[model samples]
Target: MLEGIRVLACGARDAVRLCATLLERAGAAVERTASDSADYDVILVSSDFDDANVVARWKTSGSHMVCDITATGPQDSRAGRRWSDAQIQAMSGLMDTTGFAHGAPVRIGVPLTEISAALYAAAAIAAAVRVKRMRGIVQNIDVTLSGCAASALTTFLPAAFARRAVGRLGNRHPACAPWNAYRTRDGWILICTGTEEQWRKLKQEARVPQLDDARFASLAERVRHVDELDALVESWTTTLTTDDCTRICESIGVAAGPIVGVRDLADEPNFRMRHAQAARAMKAHGVDADTYRDVSIFETSALSDALPVAKRAVPCERGANAAPLAGVKVIEIGQYTTAPLVGKHLAALGAQVVKIEPPGGEAARAWSPGQGGTSYFFALNNTDKETIALDLKQESARAYLRTLLKDADVLVENLRPGALAKLGFTREALGAINPRLVYCSISGFGMTSAYPSRPAFDTVIQAMGGLMDLTRADGAPVKIGASGADILGGQAALFAILARLAAREENAGAFIEISMQDVAAWCALFAAGNNSARGQALACLDGHIWMEREVSDAERAQCSALPKAVAAVKLAGATPVMRVDELLQDGDFLADVLSAARDANGAFWPVLKAPYRLTKTPACVRAAPGAPQAVRLAPPAPARAPVPEDRPA
Candidate 1:
């Protein structure tokens, strides 16, 4: 396959290396460039490197077909009047996983799919060159990471399009109930018995003859009795080492494997065999055989030996070819968390973000302190941005905001639904003020009427979205420890804004609306069908305790009705919330509870309710040196002051 084609590979460390490796394998002359130089027949650029200026500069000479390998879509500036089929195909594939999942879709994991796209792009360029030699049109391609990730998830799309929900199950597969990791004597082992035959084999291997009983025979029956079956399996597993269990399961022809700990797979004979075969393939090419072997130390031979070598691409240097968004100015008109966070991300990426806070400052300013008076909220989300106090209600402030809008490229806000319009800052008004501006309106629900006016805190949204419902296997709803909804929504808003910016052809100012509720619903539905298929109770306190809250008297009274051993207790008036920290400190209590719950036929103990208490205290109020201070409630003046004032008059 040795050809007369030339390939120019420009990508971040790993992506660049993969492009070069693939092209070299195809027997094409590969030219590595720190900068885009030489009139090659094919040019490959990294997607992670967002230096649009460099891309623009390279496009000028445009002798060869161009393909981007980055996770992001190409800039609007890169678009041209004419493009080839090869270029269009490459661009279509590149836009894969570059957007937000719930937020702006990001290239998760090792960007393995991006590598695939880069290879595809490289192939397209080579084809384009062959066409150009006979015919005469230079092709330009736009590749995006979002599109790549989306394509990778295409198999799941059938379910997604069917409105089936998907989510991170940690290590559990939805279809198989007992197909999960279980604690063993020494370590954990993943037990996957997807087929009925495998399930039968696994039960027999475990020596649990009771599993053969009609009540727990078939896959459906086993799943129905999963709780009891799991207990029996765990009882046997905890007595044997992971190796012992694995060997036993393997002999019985069951799909079972030990969870790999922090151990080198290179030492394993199976891993060594696979590595040797992979090395031979790598050596056939001009690439260093050892490049692929080093990462083999982490591979499990149970999978294929076609593992790609880890790329050692250098991190993007600061001020490297001018920041992608160096001249981009963003006007942030939001408070609390979601909208402000989007601006924070933009600011981090070198955008001039001007935070417009309320006259009394944002409500988050009064949030709990860390080191200084600065709340963790402000520090975490508002970093790398300038804050300015402005009350939109005031004509002076509104006029000032209008002035700011005139020069701004984007406006981000997350007031309650209809609040923005009520303030006369509607999309039409903003578009009229600055037709080129990108306006992002973040709301609890969408701008639409479904739940436009419903109040949506992170906790409330989680509850309403069925997340809380699904989390509690026992039917008790619980909010996620982190404010997942808000953060993910913020990320989604950012991605949406970027997409709008890239495809801003209409120029009437792109109006982007992101709903926190919608994101939560999406997440809920993603995993809902699979979870529902399992048909398990929604509430079961069998997992790790993520948080602890003090139990109320009413809750305590309710728990008192249970057996004494399983009854919930209040620890010094604070509900006995079983937190990991507390469990570690009071091992005796943990052991006691474990014994009690185990003996009581698997009854769960109720812990404290809320993780943290929200209390108000006057003494805690203080003012920062430069920022506004809290207003104090003064004590009543002495009665004598009235008499003194009367005498003075």
Candidate 2:
């Protein structure tokens, strides 16, 4: 949030623009100028490592957060390296975990690493803000794109950590079978049968007799014989149109949705609701609807409340547990991937998060790779959180939450636009009740956008923002393997939390909004902005080979620099075009992966480790989250106590 903070943005790269844009969107005042770094609360200098010493001093003086974004971390041998997104992806070993199992190992369509690094840098800046305010210590945040990209390889952690071999699962997630897109009579439809009950429902629709075979009764068996299982599913999917598939699946209580393009969002209930609301407003004004700009950006609120700095100075140290965010307290109400992941990230960092869910639990709990009605991903993403069943539609529940927010540092939610406001949780409303609260709202388009009411599902954001178009190299647009749009939005929300939390002092708190669609568009800033900056489109040539080595000024000046870099890597006999699945087959790559692993109680474990480790306050996943504990909340009293943060960290 850094609402009153000013940021000095220096550089002309997509990363710089993205960094500044994110800060500005989160309420920071940003100025594009290389002058007077002393005047700003944060300074972002691009491609100029020479200022490292000056930046380091600025941090030490407890002045501003100086962030350096580059291709590699300061500890890496390739510090000060310059690279394109394709180059970074090709060499990071992460690309080996993406794309088709047998096809070319392609990069995620957008500048994933750069944007992800920008996000990391932004969060670091926010974290620095918190550190500076809470402890009078200025922390320098250095982020490398390659490192942030690798940190996001959490989906690969389950197998990577267990000393088991793992590879690309393609469109099918490793956690669940039938959790992929299937062809229909008209187009494709995404569906999942994560639990036995969901499978039974589909069986009811198919009328397929003998599906109760012992071999397919359990999840392990279904995954082991996924090929055969999918064949049976195709038999039904191939017979129905996309709409029919969705309708039938919903009718039978299965998780399913039509695979639609971006333009289709306008017709969805979410966006159509916006249209209807706008029409009504126009009618009220007695004006022609066509004569007005869409008044879809709903009005939100903000406030400042003075919270006495309690004497409880929770040690801001890494502690023996290695949790950087040991004392952070977060309360969130989320249903799916985007918002849940944000809470999950904080939880992983040792924050005590309380998730408010419906009595039936969140929909994600039933997503695939589920057992006894709970999803594996839901379990993992919700790790380190406490869950409370609350019917928010009830006034009693609202009162309970208001009491909880009294001392909680952050509150995150992803309900439909205006859902919270309708529930009497507007920015102004919440701020009046608990001024030190940093409220974060993550949605599909935004809290207030032209299409404020439109659905912001991962697929919709991908399709509408053109991520699908950029991903397909030689065919029509198709979704990337990962739920990138959701992931990006989650990351954005996490970044916002850091800044907003930091901004919360004795008297002020901030309101932050993140749009999934906006984050999706950031992925293409490089491809779209390159031409305007250089008067030529960026060309990756083969789009395969990449160099991980540092590029000197002399080499960078050459018109043949890219080719030369490619040649250097090829000379080393590297397999530049290997698919992600192929990497597991390489003895050398396998060994390298093993070398990075740590031994815990005689078992080898590979962490989803971040690139730049904090020297004194590293982040760690200390323990697996179990069933959440419940708390009894009532009307607030004047005495403020910390959110119940009882955890291992």
Candidate 3:
């Protein structure tokens, strides 16, 4: 979609190279140039690249420049200190939340922060391009690895705000029972179930009478007795092989998959199928897909009659009243993480996002409590949205959605592959309805999949996508503490939509499909290629610190004699590991990464600030939706006039 755009990637860091790779896969002409003699459409400068004069020249020449600040705030207490991804994760509480409850904080096995920052940077570049086209202004964007780390704490922050301890839970989910990797006869298989019905179904399928007891009845009760609950589940799983356990769970519609390592992606059916589809698509467009790096994740296509040229206009200053997407309208039919997170970002970028859920509300709304008894998981993903419950099974609701699509600029959903298409809202149907709507689908697998009926969750995707395999705790495969696959998939979906929207003047009615499994596989590339090792926790005089490199006896002795902060600072490559409670006490960290938003009952709670920082037409988060309001849907305009835009000051 970025056919003629020229991107100058000038750094040796993995994040910079990954960002350049993403842009190139999107059809940009990328060059690694350090000199500022020639101007380019986009410039990405990593924090390690110290060339102020060259960067300034590119900025003056009206290029869309992005500087990779390692963190949202100061990387360290020391002035002008730079941090690696491990150090940033240490300070940001990502490390502390992983690993076992009894063990020290351990780093995630992959380069998660670097991958996240690259995704954010690429999306920021696309957003800048869109703003330049719409308002004729150049942008200077700032992206931070810490911002990405902080965004992963969306659900954990609520407990932190309530003064509840947010610590490591190993592979177990804090809010759900039977949501960990259970040992099968041959290997381990991950099973994740959130609702009571799924738990009942699992119990019936496994013939575990103990699981049906009153002690394991309700969601809260099951969590309260998770130890026993897990023991009962394991008893049944250990009687069968890993494949048998997966088949049993899948047969009953419970989310389950095998825990694999990075080396297994080549043989994974879903991963191979996704890439095969990407290769076919690229070859049809007369491009050699194998030549492009990271083809699985960077599947950016307009999917229309012809590719449209991205618009270029005179570089003028943005008006004080202008927002990047002030006139944009979005329809989000999403449940948990991926698509709802995209809608939240679109709303933050000044789009009017109307979230359509089932009559009983989305699944996340019933998860865990955050502020004023509202589901914190739902609140974080649905901020700044206007919500309505529609029974889409009814013809009237589907007809109303059709009417809403006629004036909407974007439609995002993460339902099963053919759920919406089965309801007559296919891409062709959407194109005929508006002929200008950008339809984006974020699914566990692509719309065309080898296993169409398989149920997927974040844990399932992590297991199948190779992330869980690479992420180990105490020599056993463990899922990331946060929903890594969901987060990456959401960011990637946003990137595709923003990239397409940048050229929407001509490339209307685009279809963007994102697979969570494929996105996870792409993020695992760095770790898989390098055989990346996980960081370990080291004991200090006062507390423990984390280090990715092996510590010598002398270094360990030195750290043992000093406090965690002092040791981390004095050591060559150590970072202070901070828990959520410790970070909540940090004023600077809180101020830089979080903002207060009201919950459903008008009570304040913390939410992540926009991940990307743009100088011109910056993205902003308005207040979170407060209190339940009766929303009445209006019929479509008789003449199909354009949707009215709402601009907020």
Which candidate leads the pack in TM-score? Answer: 3
lDDT of 2: 0.60
Deviation from native of the Cα of residue 183 in model 1, angstroms: 34
Instruction: Give candidates' CA RMSD values in order.
Output: 26.1, 11.1, 8.1
The parts of candidate 3 lying over 4 Å away from their true place are 34-37, 60-64, 72-79, 208-218, 277-294, 298-321, 366-368, 531-534, 540-543, 552-563, 569-572, 598-603, 627-649
Better of 2 and 3 by TM-score: 3
**What tens digits encode model 3's per-residue C-alpha lDDT throughout 10-41?**
85556787888877767778998645575577
Clashing pairs in 3: none
Better-scoring candidate (lDDT), 1 or 2? 2
Q: Report, for every candidate in turn, its global Cα lDDT versus the true structure.
A: 0.47, 0.60, 0.76
- The weakest ten consecutive residues by lDDT in model 3 span 308-317
Candidate with the larger TM-score of 1 and 2: 2
| Superposition TM-score, candidate 1 onto the true structure | 0.38
**Clash number for candidate 3:** 0
Model 2 regions more than 4 Å off: 36-38, 46-63, 133-136, 175-177, 183-187, 196-328, 332-340, 344-406, 413-466, 473-483, 504-518, 521-568, 571-649
